[model samples]
Target chain A: MQILEFLNTHMDMVYIVILSVLLGVEVISNVPSVLHTPLMSGANAIHGVVIIGAIIIMGKADPSNILTMALGFLAVILGTLNVVGGFVVTDRMLEMFNKKKPGKSKE
Target chain B: MGEYLLEISYLIASVLYILGLKMLSGPKTARKGNLYAAFGMALAILATIFLYVDEEGNKLQNHIWIFGGIAVGSVVGWLAAVRVKMTAMPQMVSIFNGMGGACAALIGLIEFPHYFGHGGSILILLTIFAGLVIGSVSFSGSVVAFAKLNGNMNKDIRLPFYNIINTLFIIAIFAITALLLVGTLTDPMYVYLLALISLAYGVLFVIPIGGADMPVVISLLNSFTGMAAAFGGFLYGNMAMLTGGILVGSAGTILTVVMCNAMNRSLTNVIFGAFGTGGAAVGPGGSGVEKSYKEIGVSDTAVLLNYSQSVVIVPGYGLAVAQAQHVIHELEELLEERGVSVKYAIHPVAGRMPGHMNVLLAESNVEYDKLVEMEDINPEFETTDVVLVVGANDVVNPAAKNDPASPIYGMPILEVEKAKNIIINKRSMNVGYAGIDNELFYHEKNSMLFGDAKSVLVSLVAELKTL
Candidate 1:
């Protein structure tokens, strides 16, 4: 009954999920092919939002429960890598496009 | 009040994410878009750290582990992103995406036991299983894709009856997941079994795919990672996580479809076709007829290029392999100095990933406006005086059009043969990644400039200097 009650209260979450999917599709379909790599990279970074769930679980987990702690720690690390690495790499890629004049710099 | 603040922050974060993606569509606003998304991420992380409260109204503990993990991850991620070469961008994206998938899988692993112990609801259990299976598959599949892209694994490994076996494995996974959701399978050990099977499926799924199909595979796995993250969002009912996951999921799916369309292959064909197998099969022109090609030296190529009023360069993975981007840019500049207009024709699946040639050419300071997509540039080829094919083969191959018997038939190509003259710079008379002879090489209007791409461009630049 408690779980059922919880689900009933959060039915809006399901609606949110559906609407978000539609919005996401609409927004992403407009991206040109020239920006495909950067956009993919950016989206990859966005999904690093799983770091939130990782942090939440880590916060509430029993410190003595080694399995939970280890998994939580690893999740945080990997999620951070996804977040930081995805954005930075995307920025580096987009930097090439922002500079209009050729022969400005070379890597 | 604090809870309200946390919820508001999530709402703001979601808006910023949408704005970021919208801005990302344009070249001018793309960097700002990335920064906006980064700022949103930073806001979400900070809000969660300071304001999040559980059902029991307790603040998050384990600061040591949380901060330490973030520090280690940030340093490693930052250094890797900063130092990665433009050519390695595909594999780098693969590896980073794999990490995200692994993180989501780990969340499921950590949470499954707690829910099982408490006799959690079907919805919670379904969310956990969904996250676990999808996340683990994305993780392992992306790792395989990374290895394949990085040249660590070149050959496709297909077991006998792989398609049927894979189909059955997928069905079994689904059946087990259903049983678990319905309370038919109560044992906690099934969780481990499910995770293991999912990981194995991921490896098997990617192992049989050939190199040329990597862009599609990577895009598919990228979408898988996004969906896994979305499942994680479902578990927590977090708005920002859900929105981000959905956005990525849709974006990756569109990209995968675009990549597959470029090659004229369906998703099912890409997944099960195990293309690029059979080892260099003979093409329609490969046998029964002796095809002759004209070879031109550097000076002649330069002369042909210099006298041309308009030229289009078709770049492929071979260009990246030879690191000829900079020299090619030099060639372009020299040609422009002589009043010859130059532009690059980029195939959708050129290089290794989408827009890969653009990135490579951009790194050497090739203007983005000069990099034209296949659809737009194909029409211009007719008016082009010369089509300089540099380290590119299959995209310009006319077999994709004129020969139905060709493996690449019906696929859209650059239509470079429509140009007045075609000068293909290649190392030798070798077949491309598709392992088929390009009929374009034997066309009368085509002349082969044979050498390494970098050296060829360098010599051409030198020859142009004297002209």
Candidate 2:
């Protein structure tokens, strides 16, 4: 009964999940094969939004409990790495393409 | 008021992410697209830190822990991404994706005790467990993939009856998770035990896969991390995490499917078939015919290149192994100077990951227009004079087309055999990642050029200068 209640109350969130999936598929289908690596990496970076969850948990964590605090702290660190590293690497990859025009003209 | 502001911030961030992904479809706008997504991330983080308020109207207070973690992680992540070689991009992505998975798993672990200690709803419990198990698997699986790509684990190790055992192990994991859900298991240790089992399963799942199947495996794990993050979103009912996570999950899934179609293998076959096992069983075509190949030296290769009207180069992972990208670019330019039109024919599953060959070629300053995908270049091979197969074997393997019994038969290849002169450069007569012999090597028009890719290209460049 509680599970049903929760689902009924959060139907809006469920709709968001479905629409997001459809939109993701539609947008990603247009990417040319040449951009596959950067696109995959960019998507990888986007999922790093779980850092939001990590931050929220850390804030509510009981400071008296070392296990909870430690887990929360570790989550925040790993989440930051995922977000920052994923985006930077993807940008660096695309940067190669950005420079190609100038480099070609110089030749 | 702060709650509404935070919600609005999430909506804007989600829109920017969608726009960022849309712009990624074009090379001209992709760099700015990544910046847009980064800007969105900053907006969301700032909103969370400053605007977030619980029902008790209390703001987040652990400033030192929050900022300190962000500071350390950013410095390390930024340095690693900037300092890594272009050749190492696949493993870098694997490791960073693993970090995301690890973060999700930690959230599950941190939250599980609270729910269990208070007898929370089964729905909440289910989401937490899903995040924990899936996140742990992605984290450990990606670490293994990273190790394999980084050359730390060169050999694919398959235990006896691996598929059956792996199946049983996964079933047991889910069964125990179900038991916990139904209140049959009350111990908190079960949660941690489940995470451990999932981690072990991840390792077992990926350890048997050969190098050639790494693209599918990495894409699958990337999606797994996304699904785990989405579960985190469901747990918190946060729109930003939900949208971002679902987007990644779908993107990774589509990529995995595309790669599987390229290799003509299903996702299940890639995971459980322990592919390349057929390499040892059959020679080319399984006809037991005597196969012989002619060897071409540097000077003759140069002569062939110098006389050709148009040349199409097919590159593979061996090019990366030898760090021959720069030398090959020089060769391309040298050929162009002598009135030979040069283009690179890139197979879809050419290297360790999707579009890996493009990244390697681009890093060496190969013009963007010169890199042609398989669908575009397959027809041109027929009229081309010289087809240079450099550090590549299987992608050009004619067996994929004509040999039905071959493991890679249905896989679309470069069709280099159609060219007037087919010259393949390899270190020796070794089977490629598919573990099968390439029938193209022995074709009438093909000549084997054996040497390290870098030195061989260097010699070819030098020989061209002499001509």
Q: How well is candidate 1 docked (DockQ)?
A: 0.67
Alpha-carbon DockQ of candidate 2? 0.77
Least accurate 10 contiguous residues by lDDT in model 2 chain B: B278-287
**DockQ values, each candidate:** 0.67, 0.77
Candidate 2 on B1-467: residue-level lDDT in tens? 89999999999999988988888867788888888988888899889988888779989878789888899899999999999998899999999999999999999988888897587778888999999999999999999999989989987888888888899889988998899888999999999999999999889988888757887888889888989999998988888888888888987898788778878888887887756674454464445667789999999999989999999999998998899999999999988988899999998878877788988888889998898999999999889999999888778877778887777778888888889999999999888866788878888898999999999999889999999
Q: Which lDDT tens digits does candidate 1 get at residues A1-107?
A: 85778668887886787788787788877667778888888888888988999999888888998888988988999999999999999998888776654443442
lDDT tens readout by residue for model 1, B1-467: 88889999999998998889888878778889988999999899889878889888998899888888889889999999999998999888989999999999999988888787587888898889999999999999999999988889977888999989899879978988888888788898988889989999999999998746887888888888888888888888887788888878887798788777768988888888756565444476477898899999999989988999999999998899999999999999999999999999999878888788888888888887789999999899889999999988878878788787666677789999899999998999988876778888889999999999999999899999999
**Span of ten consecutive residues with least summed lDDT in model 1 chain B:** B276-285
Model 2 TM: 0.97
For candidate 2, write residues A1-107 as lDDT tens digits: 87678769998987888898888788777667778788888888888999999999878777887888788888999999999999999998888776678877887
For residue B113, give model 1's deviation from the true position in Å: 0.5
Listing candidates in order, what is each one's chain A TM-score? 0.83, 0.89
Q: In model 2, what lDDT does residue B404 have?
A: 77
